[model samples]
Target: MELKGKIAVITGASSGIGALTAHLLGQRGAIPVLLARSEDKLRAAAERITGEYGLYRCDVSNSGEVEETIAKIIAKYGRIDILLNNAGFGRFADFIEMPVEEFGEMMNVNYMGVVRCTKAAVPHMLERGRGQIVNVASMAGKIGTARSAAYTASKHAVLGFTNALRQELRYSGITVSAVNPGPIETEFFKLADPSGDYIKNVGGFMMTPQYVAERIVKLIEKDKEELDLPRLAAAGIRLYGLFPRLADKLTYKMLNRK
Candidate 1:
């Protein structure tokens, strides 16, 4: 619950939400381990932690890399108290037009990446009989969106996996939760759509990375099963789930009018 003295591992720590979360966790007295593909970025983030923090260069998409990095962490720190599966990528295009490789990459990082990291960390947590795992999903996980079929599906899988893991670990002191952010201003949009117009229009009401980081910290302390940000967007997702056809029409009108 309390973050003070906790050893937290945060993926996607190179920038954006992951970087902000690591800094905030450090401010709360938690020792953070920054993981990402960029060694330079990881070291910069670790340096800013102020508290005890380590940087590990890892491409979460690789199962072997994930396992080996986690093993090194365990060997060095003895145990991991919190695991934040935040590393992910997105490529937006119609399913028919999207490259198979792009979809595979998305799955590899967004969905399987979570699986690999969790697979490596859960056992250690179970052995200690206490720990927390937080998967950073998206509102897209709960509802479909245009030009993001692969991304949506990947996040949906993450949400399902988190739920199943939580149920399976109910008796253990280990807690599993998922945080679904609607549209935070991050590099994800630029990477997904170079033009950036689509994301800018849709995410006009975006929350800052710091805001999302604060919410993540709160969820860690509360051990909440799910955290959805920006009440409006969360409400829209629930509404869409209730009325699929109507939601589709409204979404088309709003999102496809460009």
Candidate 2:
């Protein structure tokens, strides 16, 4: 698929993979529409883009903001050719110890955020009969891990939504895809795992945001159904699916690293 002149809207674009992906998209001739809660970060990110782009202060958790921002983008750009739902965060904690409010917040942002953005973008894509939607999920979505019950549940919801939505838009000329990557070197750990035990435990296996961003761009270009990063981790997910009991026994130590 040619990316030239495509209008791509990316959530969580203020930094991390979202920010880098916006820059990469621009390099491919796509007009990136950046959205995040931080207006200052958005402004800084926008200035760094090498080509055409749009910036919006949108909190995916708020329906009003998401709907309004999508409308504004369509109003200005004429249509949205790509929608990347990447606005999400994680906080690792035991189910009993985790705050109830934090659990709700995770669900609102990680899962419902994808829903809100996709819901708002679908109509416009349907009208044009063409577009692509990419939801950034995680490895936790595939295999449950210790000390990450809430975060895993939220990601699991994202995967469920992504699968159903993809089938729903099967012939709508719009492709829906999900990218599931393991831990990456980013500020995400600052909030997700404050003690940094998880990062230290799997430091060698961690990937960089730029590496994942490149794959995301490729996913959009190819319109792939799903992408699981860092081939080794993806294999583990598949193994767990095929042999749950054995996987649990073999991965006992690894899963508890967090």
Candidate 3:
């Protein structure tokens, strides 16, 4: 959709993909509303945008906060043209050793955050019968691997929800799309692997967050259902779906390489 004058709400807007999108969207003439838990960071991010914008301190995992924050935004803008669900975090751990609390936190922020924001914003979109909901799921959701079970599970839930919503809105003007990208260069690694094993080993192959953000903005202007970035990774994902055993062997070698 044309971003000019469009009211766009971006979750996880404090940094990384969300922050970059906020700046880029503002450049495209969209009035970007930034949402995240950090007020300071949100303010800083909004300041970096060159056009008109606003920021809200929102913890997407909190239903009441998301509901109230989103309501205020809608009340002011009167219409929302885009909702980008990008607030998420991850960690590397053996499932058996991962704490239940950490797993629940993943579900809360990574999966339920999307649900909460979407729940609040979608009704407004439905009223207008024109909007875009883009969930930033991960390649991990499509192809599981060792060391990130909880993270993968949360993203899988996101894709499931996105697919269901897209089908439900199939005949309507509202569109739901999922962007499944491989690892991008971001603070996520420090958050995911404080010990740095995952970053030191696999991070070099990461995609640039700017590249992913640009592609997402372009996809929203199209009729695409989903986007799997880094075409090679997309191909590998398809292979894993078709031949799990072969994929397991290949992935083991790939991850161990270097």
| Candidate number with greatest lDDT | 2
The TM-score values for the models, in the order shown, are 0.95, 0.98, 0.96
Local lDDT at 34 for model 2: 97
Over 4 Å off, model 3 = 255-258
Error of 1 at 249 (Å): 2.3
Order of models, best lDDT first: 2, 1, 3
By summed lDDT, the worst window of 10 consecutive residues in model 2 runs over: 43-52
Give candidate 3's TM-score. Answer: 0.96
Task: List per-prediction Cα lDDT, in the order shown.
Answer: 0.89, 0.93, 0.89
Error of 2 at 210 (Å): 0.6
> lDDT at 25 for candidate 3?
89
lDDT of 3 by residue, 81-159 (tens): 9999999999888889999999999999999999999999888888888899999999888877787889999999999
- Stretches off by above 4 angstroms in model 2 are none
Better of 1 and 2 by TM-score: 2
Tell me which residue pairs clash in candidate 2.
none
Give the TM-score comparing model 2 with the true structure, all chains together.
Answer: 0.98
Give the lDDT of residue 74 in candidate 3: 83
